[model samples]
Target: MTHYDGWFMLAAILAAFAANEVWRVVGVALSARLHEDSAVFSWVKMVATALVAGLVAKLVLNPTGGLALAPLWLRLGSVAFGVAAYALGRRSLALGVAAAAATLMVGTAVIAPGAPP
Candidate 1:
């Protein structure tokens, strides 16, 4: 690639990183001023939680390639099992991840026997 192309790509990545860091710094500053019990904090937490939930739903519904080739119902079922595991495991991240992985494997085996590697 040309030197200009390399510099352009570097500048793009740096810009993205700087944008994310700006949010982090703002959050840190705002957090210092706001108590956790404040209504604004609670609303922010809810919005963050909802955004995460939406992202998870999107991934489960339409995976990239590995799991996307599997049946839709299988993916949905695995996500449901994962959510249940997360709730039942007292919201433990590790246990929830394990359950989701296990369920995905089983679902893939049963639902997409001829899926390509």
Candidate 2:
């Protein structure tokens, strides 16, 4: 490849990073004045939580790559178990995440239709 091609790729990567960081810069600028008890902060928290939940739902419903190998029901069941673990484990997020991962592993081991007999 030509040297120009490398420069072009670097420029594209820089452009992508700049685009992604614009919001981060804005958030940092505004966060200094934001209070946790304020309505705006509450709204932001809600939106952020909803966005994460939506992302997780999307991954479970329409997984890509290796996750696609697991059935949707298994993924959903794992998420349910994780949530229960989170509640029962005194809100320990790590426990919840571990439970979800363990559930997925066990489900794959036991019910993988394509596994060798």
**Tens digit per residue, CA lDDT, model 2, 18-83:** 998998999899889999999998998999999999999999999998788889889999999999
Candidate 1 residue pairs in clash (backbone atoms < 3 Å): none
Cα deviation at 48, candidate 1, in Å, is 1.9
Q: Which ten residues in a row have the lowest lDDT in candidate 1?
A: 108-117
Candidate with maximal lDDT: 2
Model 2 misplaced regions, further than 4 Å: 19-22, 62-73, 113-117
Q: Per-residue lDDT for 87 in model 2?
A: 100
Best by TM-score: 2
Predicted structure 1: lDDT:
0.85
User: Root-mean-square deviation of each candidate, in angstroms?
Assistant: 2.7, 3.0
* Error in Å for residue 75 of model 1: 2.6
